[model samples]
Target: MSCCSTSLAAARSFGSVCSPPLTSSLTQMSSMLDTAAEQMMVHKDFQAALDTCDRGLESLANMEQEDSRCGEVKAGFCILGIQALAELNQWHGVLSWVLQQYEHQEKIPAKIMQMCILLYSKVGEPAVMQEAARVWLHCPSNSRVTGFRTVAELYLLHVLVPLGHRDEALELIVGEVGGSAFTEDQRQAALDVVEEKEQQKQEPPLNPSPNSETTAHTSSTQGAVVRKLEAMLRFFYRKLLLTGSGSFSLRKVFTAAVLLYMLFLRLDPAHPSSFMWISKLLQLLKQMWSAMFAPYHQALTHSKGL
Candidate 1:
């Protein structure tokens, strides 16, 4: 028999002893394609690597109705394809491919979606990155991926902010920080972005000459700062109040209170709303302090009574 025939006969024999013929065939095909693509990339044959990735993706499409294991394999193939395109500096091509896949499917795989976001960021396409971030946030499988929340935050700070999407960036950060789905680290990262942006807003223009344009710009910035400060205060207050049962962390409460105090000081003292927020923050801090000492107070009272 010829080499091809002999290899086919051996594959069939192996498949008979394994799980299923189609599953084995697909698995082997994916592995072989991945290896070939990697080798081509190492050799700097980017076009050849891209061609191999295309073949792998075609195979994935043909096996669309497969099991969960197969779905994962397909996602891997998609990632490989994206990487190959990136190696070739075909960023727009990668975006088009991802968008086309999104248009056809109800949901793209989480790993694939991540690759798309990373590609957009790599290509400096902030508008596309923002849209990808929105889709990623809403994806049902997003929670399964590790570090997705951090990735979302980085995208907000690095992409959205530079693109002048300040409102959208703040909205995304506030939503994540306020929601229970985020971890302390993620919440803190979002808060850092808020603080950084607030500082930038507070910086006076180097050119102090009075002009209509500069005055208008300064007013707009001040307004945005006030709104961000209010949003952050609300978030920290909710966090302080929600510390129940095993979730009570005194350190977190203290941190939130300190941040609120700093923000209060940053606000314009003449503004009527600033005074209201300052009073509210002080009351919340007092309540938290009392709550922290309540158990000790009860113990002291009981001992004295005894």
Candidate 2:
């Protein structure tokens, strides 16, 4: 069984059974101290919040011998404490503690990975981010929750980009959510950033002739234009995902997918029927891309004597 499923069963068992004294103490501790930590942190007394977390952990330890639920409570409090420490920018012990706690526990709480991802982000060391990316990539696909995916994306963006690993980053992104999975809007929004970087890298001495600088600048400008269009497309995709109805006709989805395939030829085509939806999506995407690219294209044409 999945660890989440197992943990869910344990939680159910704890809830149904009558609690002994230590169980009662652990429950009380979880309630009282978790709240106090939040309140203290809200008031900007981070140290107090930290102390509350420590106390909460101590209480759970004292109760563990008696309560069947002690292990669960301890895991819960550990996630909360680690998140609090992350907020305080206390990176030194945060990563180790979280990893150790998770490694030993049969299950960490539902949203605990969120805290780990956030803590790693705050630490922002390249080595640490690289490790995080590895964990994110290797974990069972379902191990990724909503927030965890965002963290995973951010980690790759930070670590891979600087290490001259754009191809690796792109491969990871493509494998995780291929073109079909990403809405046209998402692809569009990320386009400029992706294209511009690629363009700058390609700027050449490849043909190191006279006007090499001009050629390089022209390539950079063209890439910037593509990137801008991508950014706008991404904007549209986000809006569609956020606000688009769940009940869109199969026709609409297929049509959109097909249009996406046409627009991004390199992307794998999904259902062939998707081609039918292309006209409508094309109207929207064309306008967005045109607005983004028209000015840049105009300037480029003038510069290149084309």
Give lDDT tens digits, candidate 2, residues 143-233: 4444445544554555665455676667655665433234456545554456667778888856558887898897787467545545555
Stretches of candidate 1 off by over 4 Å are 1-22, 102-106, 144-147, 176-181, 201-306
- In TM-score terms, which candidate is top? 1
Candidate 1, after superposition: displacement of residue 212 in Å? 18
For each candidate, give its TM-score against the true structure.
Answer: 0.52, 0.44
Model 1: per-residue lDDT, tens digit, 38-102? 54545656567567656765776676456655555555545555665766667677767765555
Cα error, residue 293 of model 2, in Å, equals 71
Each model's lDDT: 0.60, 0.54
RMSD to native, candidate 2? 24.3
Clashes (N, CA, C under 3 Å) per candidate: 0, 13
Judged by lDDT against the true structure, how good is candidate 2? Answer: 0.54
Give the per-residue Cα lDDT of candidate 2 at 224: 72
